[model samples]
Target: MQTNEIDVRVREILRLALKTDVPEEGSYAREDDPNWDSLKHVEMIFMLEDEFDVQFAEDDFAKMGSVAAIVALVEANHAA
Candidate 1:
């Protein structure tokens, strides 16, 4: 709907699935972020769908990197 709404939902998803509330924009990378791993990434993707009622394709899932990227994905697919 709105940017703030999207950000809030994304932050909630990260907090719950990744176990962290810190996303400093260009400061997080998949290989370096503490909460980022293969298994947790999958969990976060599933939770994003469940929590936000959005469906992500498998390829879309791979394209997601940082928390910012996930937020962008959710916003991009929000209406679909």
Candidate 2:
């Protein structure tokens, strides 16, 4: 898939998982959004895994705190 396609899907997943619309041009982090609590974070992980058809390592879970990070991880996994 193309980068823009991955970005759009990631943003949609974040919006649905957090139940909030994400900005198109800004960094979003769990620390800055109340909607991105532990439960929601886990949910988002599952959603992303399913959406991207990639399994995440337990340690890699920690790296998914931000939209940029999540997109990067997903892209990396997809490439792998």
Candidate 3:
């Protein structure tokens, strides 16, 4: 996927996962953002899988605690 495509997918996934009608642009949601929580984690994972068509590796679960982390992971996988 192209970089812009990855970005679009990431934003959409994050928005759906966090249950936010609109996602902040150019920056990730902060750790303390009300949308960031345990329950949302599962929802995020599912949305990510559906969006990326990639099942995250086992280690990814622990690494994907924050939006920045997911952005990195998605970039890495898309680049791979």
Q: Positional deviation of 19 in candidate 3, in angstroms?
A: 1.5
lDDT of 2: 0.89
lDDT of 2 at 58: 95
lDDT of 2 by residue, 1-80 (tens): 88778888888999999999797757878887888888998999999999999999999998899888988998899888
Instruction: Quote the positional error of residue 75 for candidate 1 in Å.
Output: 2.0
Model 3: per-residue Cα lDDT over 1-80, one tens digit each: 66666767777877777767545556665465677787888788888887887778888877886566777788787677
Give candidate 3's error at residue 1 in angstroms.
1.0
Q: Candidate 3 versus the native: TM-score?
A: 0.74
Q: Each candidate: how many clashes?
A: 0, 0, 0
Stretches off by above 4 angstroms in model 3 are: 21-24, 30-32
Pairs that clash in candidate 2: none
Higher-TM-score candidate among 1 and 2?
2
Candidate 2 stretches with Cα past 4 Å from truth are none
Per-model TM-score, in order, reads 0.77, 0.91, 0.74
